[model samples]
Target chain A: MEKRFLAIGWVLSVLLLMGSLSGCGNIEPWVKPYERDRLADPIMALDGDPVSTSYLQHVYEAREGARGGEGAAGGGCGCN
Target chain B: MAAKARPVAAAAATSGRGLTMMLRYGLGLLALLMAFSTARASVLPEDRADVLYHLYTGGGVDIDGPSILVRKQVGKSVSVVGNYYVDMVSSASIDVITTASPYTEERTQWSLGMDYLRGNTTLRVGYTSSEESDYDADTYNFSVSQDMFGGLTTLTLSYALGDDLVRKADDPTFQRDLDKQNYGIGLTQILTKNLIATLNFETGTDEGYLNNPYRSVRYFNPSDTSGRGYSFEGELYPNTRTSNAVGVRARYFLPYRAAIEGEYRFFTDTWDIDSHTASITYIHPWRDYTFTGKFRYHDQTGAHFYSDLFPSAQATNFRGRDKELSELTSYTFRLKASYAFLNESQSWGFLKKGSVTASVDWLFVDYHEFSDLTANALIGEEPLYSLDAAVFQLFFSFWY
Candidate 1:
């Protein structure tokens, strides 16, 4: 079982590596820098408060059976 | 290595030692490592500080603590961050009440991290340690993030390793070790002038003693003298489990200067636990105050070996009664308000802005199989267990 898990991890890691290797160069920003004012607004900030967010995520993890894959966080127990 | 089940009451007390802090949140700052890293090919994180008070009450348990975080840039290319957190728990929980005396315990954690940026790439390294009377854990992690496609997209790859030692309070020589590993990939994209999105995928594995020695599975014992028809035995769990999760989120700016976001995630593990979670949030700024509301929903299947009551002892190779492993559905509703007291116009020295925010979350859960033993009902006629919890967060943050 352990060997099988390691194999799954390695295979996915390789696929992710391949996907990341296919980037760089120009993909023109459809929305110019100047047009991103709304996107840059504080309200639109994806993760504005790191401490608060991390604490809440930890609480959810402790109580739920699920963990990880939610925003660099864990089990998506959805107690967000 | 697989462990032999052993009976003990101390495990119920150690239940609050904290199982989640070992992971160290690789997701919280991935965006800050990328989208926020734009413009300057080598931009370190911003300097900031936060002090917070958090409280959770429910399930006959009370956990309240203080968390302090500080981040400062050491130079043009490097930034450092540190955190000190504590959890003071008073638990008279269902498990504790059933088999042992109520207990009070404290868990403290410390974390330090550094980020180095060169060109359009950022490298991060971190360490975290958590300690309690019967449990101790340490984790180390590293990650690299790149700004691709003219800063329109960001990709972050990360890995973490954890080592944990669990000890039985009543048995001086009884101890166990658990090892864990996590792998993650995150992508952030600027979808449009008014929209942004992130997709994160994480996989992990755990090995060694995975069950609580202080926790037990209940089984019918016809000859038991106790009026209750059931008896308890130590829980037995598989020695290894692998899990996978994928989550995606999107935030969009409303035409009226408000923001709305939606998130969805799917999770599955070798233990046969599958879960789906979704949430929606709305943020609105009025004058100096930002008001936000969120609703979240989650549903999951029980682990393969989870059973509230077994027909007899050793009914299965692995038996567990932990409610968290039971099929359940949960909902959370939150309301938050943040007031900005300082901004560019009212800056204080090196502090460019400051805000104090408070939020309250109401949580409710309905268990499909786990029964509430506190009711003291007859066998097989017990009421389904449910939980209600309230979480409160109050904090002040300053950014330079």
Candidate 2:
């Protein structure tokens, strides 16, 4: 299982590197000021409600064995 | 009709004037340039406050709480944030009923953070502390983010450390300590005018006592002279654990004022547990209101030393009966709606850009290897355990 995980990690790293390189090109045009209204909307934010997301993360962490990659570290609880 | 025609003719005559047209075009260009310049400059966060209420119900456990968070811009390039949270939990689960009596507890948490911005880089640091009757924890975190490619790309790195103290409520002197550390990296890119993507990787390590002090493991007694019997013993677990996770998220906006988002995550740990998660969300905006629907699926493999029952003759140094360590799968569905009640142009007294949001989620979980101890079946013949849970939240936010 460790070997398999290492193989997957390598593959993902390669793919991400390739994508970043390709993205460095000038193939896409810049968005205009008038066209930014939609992007500036609150719904377009990565985390619109920080308080609610924090609660969700806490519940999941207590119930599941896996954690991290979402946000900052938080206080621990004795739910289990 | 005559008045409209006269106005149209006058506009046509004005267009025929070349100098007037040139002056108008030049002024328009200047205004556009000014807008662009202002958009490129760094902007400070507005002073805002959020009040949230949350409720959770499942598997004979109930939790309800309220949280408040406030952010204030201290200066041109500095911001401060503070949070206070509380959780009131009441539990009467099968485990508690069989081993101990039902109980109610209250947990409180406090956090403070600061952010500093300079040029294209931002630095953030935070501290959090939580206290309950039998547990106390403190965590410190720091992160830095840098923007590149003319604000098209962002890279972030973060680290956190936690110190926790766990104690048995009945045994006053019985206390244990644990330490946790985490490291993470993230990258975000604007793939196109209507698409954005992010990739994140995190690794965490835990050392010292990591198991609940009150949990017990069931063992079959073979040497019983009268009949086959069962004995319960305290659970034991390994002292060290390490885990890693990688995730990718993407969002794309449709042409008709709607957006779609997708996320996938892979997780693995030293305990031989592997898991996968996939989720998708759709968001639609109409006037000043936004509505969202989301679905998530998660599946995981059991740890190496987890079991429902163990033979009395076979004793191992590391044994666990926690259902969370067993093979399991879960599905969650969520619906959310938010409305912007006030805008900057129409402020409510001293507050601006007020919004209210409400969300609800339903979750179902099935355990593959763990049995329901509350079942009528004998010993190891108990039925599999499954659970249904619900979560609800309502929040109000305002900026000044």
Candidate 3:
């Protein structure tokens, strides 16, 4: 099982690297300033509410065996 | 001839005065343009603050708390943030009631952070500290993000280190220490004008005294003249553990100004535990209100050392009876709504850009291979355990 996990990790790493390299050229569309209203909306933010996200993150960390990869790690508890 | 010369002189004087007036008007226009440019250049992002109240109840536990966060931009390229969070927890779970009386405890956590941006790169550093009746922890974190492809893609790298001190509230001499570290990398890309995707990988390590000192393991007894029974002993665990997780998330905007989001995560650990999580969310916007619905599913396999009951003769060096280490599956459903009461660029009194949000979540968990120890002790037969929980949150945010 450990070996299989390692293999999957390697594959994912390679795929990410390849994708990044292949898109080296400027393939992205030009976004005009006036067309950025949607992007600037609060809903487009990765985390719209910082305090709520922090509380939820702490709850999940205390309940589950898995953690991290979502965002910055802060705060600790003695839930167990 | 004299009269003609006088008329020519007057005409020359009139032309000269008109030229002077034009120069004065040009200078005045230039000054106004300079002032407008300066005002535009000096305008910085607004400072924001948030207050949230959270309540949780279920599974013989109740938690309620409030948190506050504030962020301020120091200049065009620097920002600072601070937060304070508190949790008041009361538990009467099976394990707690079986071993000891029900108890209530409080935990407080505070954090401060700074961010710096230059060109297409951003740097962040943060510190956190938390305190409880029997535990204290401190953590430090740093991260860097760089934008590529003219802001179409962003790459991030982050690291965190934590030191924790654990002690028994009743025993002053009992003390233990733990260390934890995590390393992570992430990539976010805009696939199309209406689609965005993100991928993240994280690896973490924990060392020194990873088990809860208060928890105990149960072992079946065979030699007793009395009926078959179980004995409780202090639990033991490995000293070090390493874990890894990979996650992928994507969002697509609909033609009607709505959005759909999906996420999946895979996790593995050195303790031979594996887990998977999948979730979906839909967000809809009205005139001044936005509503969201989300659902999540999670499943996990038991750790190698975890067991409901162990035979005395078959006991190993490491024993674990913690329910979190047991095979389990869970589901979560959530609904949220937010209203932008004040979204105009102009400020009202001392506040600007305000929103109020409220959300509710329901969670259900089922343990597959683990049984209720309390029930087993009473009836001599174990029954499967399940839990139902609910969470509520209300948030208010405003910018200045």
Candidate 4:
């Protein structure tokens, strides 16, 4: 199983490296002042920077123990 | 790199324009030049990077491998970030296997992302892909954030689409795959100079097979044991889980360049799980650097269907399941520190501004069961157990 996993990882790494290199030449710096401001609007935070660590800890406990499916599903058990 | 070219286009100007029109054109040209010059002057630093690692020992064993991340600014409004992570886990904490042995699980994840800044707004887009020993996942995500009221208020929107595939250990015919989509919206308000509050909502939808081939539940009827006994097989959960959270944090600056921050989170999911977490950090500045310490606490409860025992096989409602119901609870603690130095500077003997940080964290897990399922055929009924683990992380970031 370990050998198989290593083989798969090596193949995928090669593929990803090739793909990234191919895009290097075409990767343009897209900068639009108005659009950039629109993007920064606070309504969509990825994980809420300042308080994210504690929040993630809370969610992890919910999915593993006290909470059920009120949030996203877990990899195995959905117990809360 | 042919796709990297974006030339500034010249504006159309009338050859025989009025003096006012000519003056307006001249001012527009000057504004355009200023914007270009600002872009040229802003450069992304080459030395910014981060690393994180974690481990959990005791009843619920988890050992996360070393993970690394690096970020580089490519242009005025563009920066690129890359990351890689690996983790290996053991299954002895759950008490399912007969031996005191452990099953091995591994996962690898990587991603590349771009962040763009314009005035008071920032836009970020990225693609990440991950592969487990037997599962695969790929995600494409994008988000936009803006600062309002002179940085007092912030808002963001994000979306992601992903694909998941799960393969069972022994069953060739039992394969599960799902298409998943997630969306999030958040808002942060600065109630005062020292207080901040944030509210966020996230929703996800998944469609396809959802069943664990190696998991089971006990039977209610004694007759249903049939010696082959109480574990349910091949059942899938079809409900969607939605979550909403509200949080508040405050920071107070003290004398001698010291500050304290406290934060709390209230979260709930559709599966009936509600949780609360709180943490505090203290930062103190020394001669040329700062040191920080953190502490946190968390708690959670069990779902409605959790059960500790199964009935006799003769009972009519004999479901022969063991897992759909088990109570769970846990706690965690962490400590970390960082130091910075001046590696390169324009002036005197002060260290030239480069920083390196290293930290260590320890965690523990305790689990209990209420049923005879513990002493079942595959695994002898055993009491609760505790899992313990520790992790180390190191990182460096610099500005030129």
Candidate 5:
């Protein structure tokens, strides 16, 4: 099981590296920056309320056996 | 039956003086790490403040607290945030009532963080500390994020270190040390104008004094007759543990300005515990009110050393009866509402927007292996234990 998890981690790393390398090329973004109004909508925020989200995640961690990988952005991130 | 089998048994001498304290804050360390996963674009954080009240009641346990958070930008390149959180717990749950007496405990935690933005890159550093009567923890973290593909994708890398001091309430001289480390990576991709997705992976490790000081394992003793048929011995656990989790989430905008989000996570640890969790949420906004609903499910396999009842005294090299380590399935249903009391058209001085949000989550869990000792049934015929809990949260947020 440890080997399997390690292999999976490696695969994810490779995917990230490959995706990042693709950004090195002269490829054009499929979604133009100006067309991101919908994505920028407050309702569409993946981690909108950092305070509330992290608090609730804290509650779950107290009771559940599982932890982490919740994908909360941050209490403070350089995002305006 | 398990509790009636043995009333007071202590193996605390194995490790030292037997001192017992609740571990309500032991898990807060993980929250600190998850709070700053740090996946943001090449923009500065918005200035905001939040005041929140939370309550959780279920299975004869009551937890209530208040949380305050504030964030502000300094100049054009730096942003700072701080959070103060508390948890007041009164527990008479099945474990307490069955093994020992009821107790009340309080935990307080505080965190400080800073973010710096430079061109298309962002850097963050943070520190968090939590304290209780029997436990104290301090953590330091750092993260970096970059925007690529013309702002279509954001990737973040983070690491954190936690230092913990564990002590026993009854034994003033009893103290132990625990160290933890966490590593994480996250990616956010804008798939389309109306769709966005994120993937996150985290790995963590812990060493030294991993088990609960007060919690005990049940072992059958035919020679004893007391409150229960068994005896309680201090739980023994492996000193080191490693865990990994991967989660994926996607959000899509509806045709009519509504939104739907789905998420899934898989977790595994060296203790042989594996879990799968999933959730789906829908948000609908009508004028000043936004209504949201969600459903979440989680299922997990038991740890290798956990058992509801051991056959005899000192039956296993390591023993534990912590319900959280048992095979179980849980479900949660959430209802939330947020009111935009002040929007662009209605701003108040320095505030850009303000909202009040309230939410309640109903949780249910079924333990596949753990039994309801209060049932007083025969040993093997004991019925499975179940739990129902209600979690409530109310908060006000303002962005300036």
Candidate 6:
């Protein structure tokens, strides 16, 4: 199981690294120095800002050992 | 004396020049440190605000209730958050004593959080208090994070302290005083623009009374002549436990406005129990709305010496109890989906630039037992597989 997890991690890391590097290739093309205050838009801060409705729903569920935020906080209940 | 005076005169001249240079260098170093500290706290834009509220309702093997949270950024570097939650649950768990009452517990929780960002670092502090019918608790948490490797990597360290006071009706003298502490360190690396990976490790420790005063193990008389029929008063006191967990999660962007994330966690505790959790999620984005779906699986082994019954005439100094705490195991499966709506421009009279989200979750759990003590012990009448729960939640957030 450990080996399997490792293999999966390695593959995902490589894939993501490649994607991020390649994505930088287009930075100049779509680069709008300013785009209507992305922070004002919820989608841009989807990962960090916890004040969103979905974030709360997921946090509560994850703390309860239930499914939550896009597969985040997947773990056992310490109290259980 | 003349030669010495000549060298001293020359040295004095050099000393004057060197003193100024050293003074300037010192001032520059001080300025850099100040800049570094400030850099940790990045300023938030003045025109942005966010608020959110959530409500949850559900029942099954697990019960869900309602919760609310609201946050606002009032300054360039400061945001305040408040949260409250209430839950009423009836749990028929597959724990050590399969036969205990379906715990109908009531819980209330409240918390406040503050965050400051400057330069390339963020600092956060929060305090939380909770009451669950017979139990009361208070917790404090602080964390600091710094962006590394030019924003590709982030490192964070967090610490938390908790105090619990549990009052039980069974033992008038029973005061379950507990102290819990946790320390976590994590790193998040943006491997690629579309892929983010994070690794985190946490250590938690609990000290003081760790047993349930109302729960007891019933000992049965063995057929042998060894007077084993008498039940023993079992109680545990002042037990300390520590737990450590490591987890890794990654996000992979897919084609056509979609992304997939996968996560794995491994956990173990001083009670000799080990567990693992795995989960996957997929996100789909549309013009003004977004949807997400996720599935999770978790498995755990029970602690050592956990049982529902024991031999009454054991030769050792045994707590002749029907329930042994360390011998039960369980597994759970959960599925959830959520949808969110983003506001493009000001909607309400005030700045209403927030998002609304709603989600549903389902969970199933199965319990297991270890020994005959557990087999014969009166457990919950419900089948092990009868535990299931469905949760629904709606949340709305806006900023000024």
| Top DockQ hit | 5
Candidate number that wins on TM-score, 4 or 6: 6
DockQ of every predicted complex: 0.31, 0.13, 0.13, 0.03, 0.33, 0.05
Give the chain B TM-score for each candidate: 0.90, 0.87, 0.86, 0.71, 0.89, 0.74
- Residue lDDT tens for model 2, B225-344: 534366667778888777878988887878888999999889998888899988999999889999999999889998887887887734777888777788999899999999999999
- lDDT tens digits, residues B1-400, model 4? 0000000000111122232332333333323322222122222223355555544444344444655677777766777888776655565544354213457677677777887876545577887777765566777777665544334444555556666666665566656665655555556554433334455544444445433435444444434455543433322343343444555555555533566667676655444546666677776657655566667655444333333333432333222122222344445455555565644554234323466656555554444553433444443354544445554555554443
Location of the lowest summed lDDT over 10 successive residues in candidate 6 chain B: B1-10
User: Best to worst by DockQ, what's the order?
Assistant: 5, 1, 2, 3, 6, 4
Clashing residue pairs in candidate 2 (N, C-alpha, C atoms within 3 angstroms): none
Model 3 local distance difference test score: 0.69
Q: Give lDDT tens digits, candidate 1, residues B1-400.
A: 1111121100111111112322233343443344334343535666999999999999888888999999999878888999998888888877777766777878888899998877777788998888877778788877887775455667787777777788877788989987777777788887887888889887777777888767888999878789798998989999887888899998889989899999999999889999999999999999999999999999999999999999999999999988888999999999999999999898999899999999999999899998888899998999998889999999999999
What are the per-residue Cα lDDT tens digits for candidate 5 across B207-233? 788777878888887666774668878
lDDT of 3 at B98: 56
Question: What is candidate 4's TM-score against the reference?
Answer: 0.64
The CA lDDT of each predicted structure is 0.78, 0.71, 0.69, 0.45, 0.77, 0.49
Q: What is the interface RMSD of each candidate, in Å?
A: 8.6, 17.3, 21.1, 19.0, 8.4, 17.5
User: For model 3, what is the alpha-carbon lDDT of residue B396?
Assistant: 95
Whole-model alpha-carbon lDDT for candidate 2? 0.71
> What C-alpha lDDT, on a 0 to 100 scale, does residue B304 get in candidate 6?
55
For candidate 1, the per-residue lDDT at B10 reads 9
After best superposition, candidate 6 residue B13: deviation in angstroms?
Answer: 62
